[model samples]
Structure formats: structure tokens, C-alpha cells
Target: MINAFMQARTGSTRLPNKVLKNLQGLPMFIQQAKRVQRAKLVDNLVIVTSTDESDDIIEQLCNENNLLCFRGSLSNVLSRYFHAELNYPCDAIVRITADCPVIDPELMDYVINSHLKNNNDYTSNCLVATYPDGLDIEVISKNALHNAYKYAEKPSELEHVTPYITSHPDKYRLQNIQSEQDLSAYRWTVDEPKDFELISSIYENLYVKKPNFNYQDILELLSHKPELNLLNPQIARNEGMVKSLKKDKEEGYE
Candidate 1:
């Protein structure tokens, strides 16, 4: 079975409870979860969050929505993922983040199909980042995830799962699914207030008309109103990973 695990928490420093922020009367994470459920390749979807008291509300939300959830480490997200897989074993795991409220289901199925067809140990569109930041997706084999859990030591590797597998390419087969056109410049992730505003605007414009809006729909919207990109202009992608790398260097894990 292919299980999609969404990493979530309410402890975001840039925007606390950002996942709980509403879009079309549903929390941003729920909206993303609902979209992920539409993927034909995914057999199960689980919301993986930390076991901190701050994340209690996340668990409560999962219960209220009847969504599957797993609670684990607060800082060590790799450990969280590893344990989540231990409890809910699957053939391969799909890693997603809660910050992406506008993630496309069709795009998810495409990458997952590639991963299974190629027999890759790891597969992702963001390996080269041809797609938008929020639409990033990763598929890792069960064995690869186990190796990462057992061997990863750096702060970055522990905080951001799959870095260990990507770093040691010789140990595992990796594949990257790319888009026909490079749309990497577009930012659809929610990390800060401005990001939230941009995503809110996207939902307001698209969600009511067609609830299952894809990345193409978003691109069309941007083509018409180019100024929407200005809402969260020039924000660096993977800022959290950069911060974790900084911590790794400080701790002599580099």
C-alpha cells in the first residue's frame, strides 16, 4: 500500500498555527489533505505531527475530521516519519508538508506513478524543482526510510527527512519527475503572513468556482493577475532546511 504522510504542527515560528488558518471554511492543512485524498495512487493519507502539547489541537482536528494521525518527536521530524511508518507500514511513503494548501492531486499521482514504475528508492519533483515550491512531493521506499532513520545524525537530516537519502545517492536509486515547463518561480507555500495572504487570495479566486484547482489553474490565475506574485515576493524556498543546516554547522555536524 502507498501511504501519504503529511507533516504538520502548530509551532511554526514564522506563522504560528498557519495550518489551522482557514480557507473556504476549512483549515489550510485540511484543504490540502482533502486534495491529497483525491490522488488515485495513494491508498492512505495520514497526518504526522509532533507529540508536544502545542500539537494537541492538531490531533483534535484530525479526530474532528476523521483523518488518520500519528504523533511523534517535536524537533526530529525524520524520527517522527520513521515511527509513523513503523506503526502504519506501507510499500512506499509519500512525504508532504502542511504549508501547501493548494497542492495538486493529479501532480501527486504523476510522481507516485513514476516512483512505482521506475522502482526508484526515492522519487520527487523537487529534486530539481521544476514545479512550484508548495507543490513539492517526495516518495521514499520503506528500506530507504529505515536507513535514514538508523544513520542520519546531522540536525538538518533529522529535522528535514530524506536529506540523508538524497545526500548518499550511491546507496539508493533516485528519480526526479520534472514538469514540461519550469514553473519553479511561483510560490504557493504558506510560511509567513504575506504567504498566507497570497494563498488566501488564490483560494478566494479559485476555490469557489472549482474546488479542485490544480497548478495549471493557479498558473492561469497568475497569468491574468501578475501582481499576485508580488504578495510574497522573493521569499527563499526551503528556508527551514537552511536554518537546520545552519544549526548543523554550529554543532559541528557539517
Candidate 2:
């Protein structure tokens, strides 16, 4: 059984104290957790957060909800994940960020099932999904993470979590889950003021009627309101070192 690592925190340099922010009456982390918990493939969910003083509230929230939570290095995220693997009944780990409240459960099931069926060491679609900004999910074996903890030497590897494993295909099997639809224009992640506005706009238009709507529904809604996609033209970029290395090697840079 793979445990879902709902890695989250209260600290964000760009959007400080955003995770606890309410989205349509629910805390952002709770909304994210609710989505992941609805996924059929996840056996358990553990929210891995930082030990930062601000995150104490997160621990309290997890406790109140009876959801598993762990706190470790504020920046060294790999240690947080390592501790999660040690403490949980987790064969694999599903990486979910706190910022994305609109995470898709169907996408989560697709990636988790694919990872299990193909036996890939690590699997994700958002890396390639291009389904807009927030529909990313990472599933990886606990062993693969241990390998990353042992080998990936970069500072970002520890701070940024599983990029080292996902980027390095030579070290482990990697898979990309993508949607047939090009939802590349929607802004679903809450990183900047514009992003928050776009998300709030979605809720204003949809949440009153449908709270459990999927990614495709949101895409369709945003397509009708094209201006919503333009709220944040450039969301956060996924700069995986392994992916960067592959790109460099392909270009014969080294």
C-alpha cells in the first residue's frame, strides 16, 4: 500500500501563509487533503510539513482532522519524506503539494494505478501533463526515495523534495501522465496574487454548485472564461535537476 505524502507548509516566500488560507470556506490544506483522500489508489495520506514555528497550526489542524502529519527540516524536505517513510505503513509515496487545492482525483488515480501497473520506480503526469498548473501528482517507491536520499547531492534535492528521483531516469524508471486535453492555460495553483484571484474566481463561479468537480470541468469552465487563464500567465516552473541534466545531455552541452 502506498502512502500519499501530502507535503505542505505554512511558509511560502512568494505567498506567505497561504496553505491555511480558506478556499470556499475550507482551509487550503484540508481541501487538498480531501481531494487526495478521494483518490481510490491511495491507501493512506500523510501530510509532511516543516518544523517551522508557523506550521504548528498545521499540526493542530491535522490532529483535529485525524489525518497523519509529520514535521521535519523547514528547508530540507528530503528528511521530512525520509521520516515519513520510516513512520508510516507506506510501500510507495504520492507527492502532493499544499498549494494546489484543485488537485484532480482522477489524475491522482491514473498516476497511482500506472505506477503500480507498470512497476515504475517513480511516476507523474504534471511533469508532462501540461494540464494547466495544478494537476500534478508524483508516485514513487519508498526504495527509490531512499536511493535519492543516498545519491542526489544538490541542496535543492533536500529542500525541494523528489526532483532528484523524478529527473534521473537512468537511476529509476520514470513515467509521465498526460491528459488528452490541452489545459495548459488554466491557473489552478495558488502561488501569487493573480493565481489566488483566479482560484477564487473559479470557486465563485463553480463551488456554489459543484465542489467535487474534476480538472476537465474546471478546464471547460476556464475555457469559457478565457480571461481567467490570463490572470497568471507564468506559474511556477518545475526545474528538476535531472530533467535539466537530460536536456543538457541531449543538447551535448557536456
TM-score, cand. 1 vs. native = 0.99
TM-score for each predicted model, relative to the true structure: 0.99, 0.90
lDDT of each: 0.94, 0.81
Best by TM-score: 1
- Which one is best on lDDT? 1
lDDT digits (tens) for residues 47-153 of candidate 2? 99888889999999999988999888876788888888888857799988888888988888988899999999998876665677677788889899888888766
lDDT of 1 by residue, 87-142 (tens): 99999999999999898999999999999999999999998988998999999999
For all candidates, the clash counts are 0, 1
